[model samples]
Target: MATSTPYSAPLDNEKFLYKLVIQLLIFCQGSHRLLEPHLLAIGAKLRSGANSQELLSELQAVSKTLVHISKQAKQDVNVGEGDGAALQNNYLLERLDELLNDAEVPLRFQHQTSLLKQRVRANLSEDSYKKVIDSAITLLLNIKDYSVSEQKGIDVFLGDLSDRLDELGQDVEIAGQANREMIDNRENLNTEIHRQVGSLKDSTQAAEELDILKNQTAEYLDRLLEQLLEHKQIEDERQRDAQEKIELMTKKLQELETETETLRVKLKIEHDKALSDSLTGLPNRLAYNNRAEMELKRWKRYRAPLSLIIWDIDFFKRINDTYGHKSGDKTLALVAQLLLNNCRETDFVARYGGEEFVMLMPNTHAFQALEMAENTRKMIQSCGFNSNGENVNLTISCGISDFNESDLHDDVFVRADQALYQSKQNGRNRCTVFAA
Candidate 1:
């Protein structure tokens, strides 16, 4: 029966078992597409009507192959089981957190976004993730609306400012021209009065000398009196016109002053905003540049000891990647506050740019600045940072350089930066002073 099985399955049981095995293989192949290739090979062998032993051997081979594949699938799934999954999730969440941080919004929306970003975590539950995503979407929409409204407001403000400035300029020009014309008219009136007075004196002397000329003198005096009266009327009209023009000019000047005051206030606000860092509320790079230039000038004039310290947050990017950008911002603000609090009132501290800060210490030598920087580093290292209820230890590196007799403004910065690089290249969380 076994030998004849290929040509004719003699027993009904054999034929039934064969049909059952074929159907089972078909069902498994359909269910598990991964096993299709192995199953297809087995199916081909079975269709050739091989003997029982050959079929059994082929079945065992396919079963072994399937088992190996199943193990590999489990391993693949387990690859993201622990820290790997958290890292992957944090990668995406950090990106979202960065977007939230970079968005410009009103204070209210900013607060909302800050809260939302704080909730970002590497190991978020599905529900928590969805909630955060929905909140982010809502915050983004609100920010967009606010931006549109703010842009319109800015446009209107600029238009009003421009119009006021133009009006002020025109008023000043008109006032100046009116003053010039008034001065010229006054001079000409004085000249005409002097000439008329001289002519009247000469007529009086002639009238007293010749009685024959008395009638002519009387007619001339009457004509001179009429001319004097006309001149007086003209002077009165000129005085009225000058008074009116003075009042008009005074009102225009008052308006101009008011407009100029308004523009000054607006410009001051804009200037402050431009020089301030929105993130940490510290002076920005522009402010830093201005301060540095002023300090350099002072150093040159007085030969005062002026030291520059460049501070960089160690592993700042890692903080953002591991925790979130919100945490990174918080860290920056905290560090800024620390630096501000520790520095002298006369010292200038500014946020140079992301994760870096510059400090100008007037009347301080490089050694003194280095000491201060070391203390700051130690303070930062000891300070505890909590993100998502977890403690994150932070550290900072600093480089110090002071102005020398021959050093340019940029030379100090370059030396400090190089020193900072050295501090980083060496073990971080320390301070290094430039040698030269």
Candidate 2:
């Protein structure tokens, strides 16, 4: 494939990528930039199309989640749907973590996104969302590098993602299933109630017949009083038996509920921390490794397209050296903030270490990753530093690499690191794809 665009114009693949991304974001139904970092990490390791598709589907799912949440939120009328609010909030955290996340994404962006999510949640209308989606499509169609083939590819990707979204769209199917189950249970309950009522009616009729017989037995007055006493005793025994049955059902129900609660809490804790990058609020190392492993396995199984990017701060030691540790810390934080700001929710951004950032992009190829790496490189270059009252200009060198099942994360790292070294040698503040 040709790497360069037409001579007269500069092609922006990132913008091209984002146009679809924006539309998909809108398509995700107003879920608010919720993305999963682990999926990108996994995409890097894809050795099969199946794995790549799986990761792509995951990314698509994030978009679907946004829509689902938006619809659910608009439907929520109560002032405080406590648990609902928490779930929505958790979803928001997970979603925002994807887009506005990095080892050093700015506090300002975080603040802005946090505020916007709240507002968006408050009154997200389909019409407003439609406007955003229309604009997103327009912006995408206008990009200079958007060739017919590229545009077609994007549309195809969108189709695939849409298909996956549609598959997930049946998320309501589970609810419907539960409702059906409830209906069945109601039917069973009604049947049991009727059976009990029938039995009670039969018993009542038998008692009434006995009472009439006794009332007509004037010659056997003693026998009539004795039968009435026996009837009262039978009623007491029936009430006692009914109470015992209720107690047994209550105990069994409570036990089952406690067990379910325990399992849910345990599962949720593992899931929440597993995919999170605590220090930077990006995807954690565990998530990255697991995702990469999963994607690689999938790639090996299905032969799908995938790629990786390793970009770190240039001369990071000097920043710590010249600016002191606090400034260094600030710089790292700032850089993390930058990565978070620039990336899509589906893009994974994690701090590799003291001054390095890595991204795992599943649906994108090497060239696209390179373009993105360049944009990041330039952004960091232009992103002048800030401390008490001083300003410092900075630059970053980046490296790009693609991978497969035969390729280990370590090998990919080596290639990208070498590429990064080349970028540095070539004069920092640029991107280099692995030549070897």
Candidate 3:
């Protein structure tokens, strides 16, 4: 008999089909125009177990429309493109772009896109409206080859694979049953032998019968004792084999645990490295971006105060030119340490890029933030570094901007940057607050 391999199912074919369709639609959004909301609408219906044929027909119509609009879009515009027809068409296209962009987020999709689409239909000329619908349909139909041909192949493969797995599972079950039956037979034989030995012992209690059968009984008893000794030796060997297997498994488990710990430590180190500035040992720009966004959200929710401070080393390029890059690096690191030491735990400081750093101060107003920046500037000016036995001193300029009701995360940073430019313009080593 041939041995069969054990099998487990991969992803279900139906589930895979649905996911593939969704991915195709998402991909189309980047390449094609006006397809996202229509695809999204179809996707919603498909998931609700709606009729596939009906949905496919709807998609086909949309695909045709998309192809028509795309062809029109690809045509060269006339030299005098500011014609009323062109302007109206461009305005319509802009709104459609917004609809598809907003449809990327699922929760905001229906309400935003539906309302926008309605507004667009009301404002657009009849010809422009037709073009939009046609363009959307064409983009969706482009996936027909994947959804139809490839999907059929996958379904057949999964069906055949599932059948083979069922057959193998049945074979394993039957073999297990046969092994159990053999063990049961052996147990029954042992019980019969015990019963016969007990009967013979009872017969031996009669003296005349004992004398007649003594030699035969002694021969039979010796053979039985020898058989019992062989069985005991077999059991002893089995126990030794089991003990070896247990020891091997225990050693393997310990090895696995050690490997897991090593991997965990390596992962943690990599995670920290990704977010850290190697030279200054401060959070890098990428880390700063994430922290600022979260802080902005918190400020918006509670209407609490938030402020940003931007810092730059005064005449940093001149220092790098005079002392070489290594000395410049030492100065940057020194300034980073000074700011870190002066800030509270709640504040976040990050190296924004080359000789520049940003501090995000929560619950700090404009004036308060300026005070902190001034203190940092004074400390940096007084701080000295011993680089190659040369006493090196550093000074920094800072800019402060506080969060307001109208402020976005980027707005706060931009204002602080403008103030920093002003400080650099006025003099080298002073803090400047943003005027607006």
Candidate that would win on TM-score: 1
Scored by lDDT, the top model is 1
TM-score-based ranking: 1, 3, 2
TM-score against native, each model: 0.58, 0.44, 0.45
Candidate 3 deviant stretches above 4 angstroms: 1-246, 300-303, 384-393
**Per-residue lDDT of candidate 1, residues 76-108 (tens digit):** 788758558667666777778656544444656
The superposed Cα distance between candidate 3 and the true structure at residue 58, in angstroms, equals: 88
Model 2 lDDT vs. the true structure?
A: 0.62
- In TM-score terms, candidate 3 sits at 0.45
Error of model 3, residue 416, in angstroms: 1.2
Report the error of model 1 at residue 300, Å.
8.7
Off by over 4 Å in 2: 1-275
Query: Which stretch of 10 consecutive residues in model 2 shows the poorest summed lDDT?
Result: 99-108
Q: All models: lDDT?
A: 0.80, 0.62, 0.71
lDDT of 3 at 168: 51
RMSD to native, candidate 3: 31.7
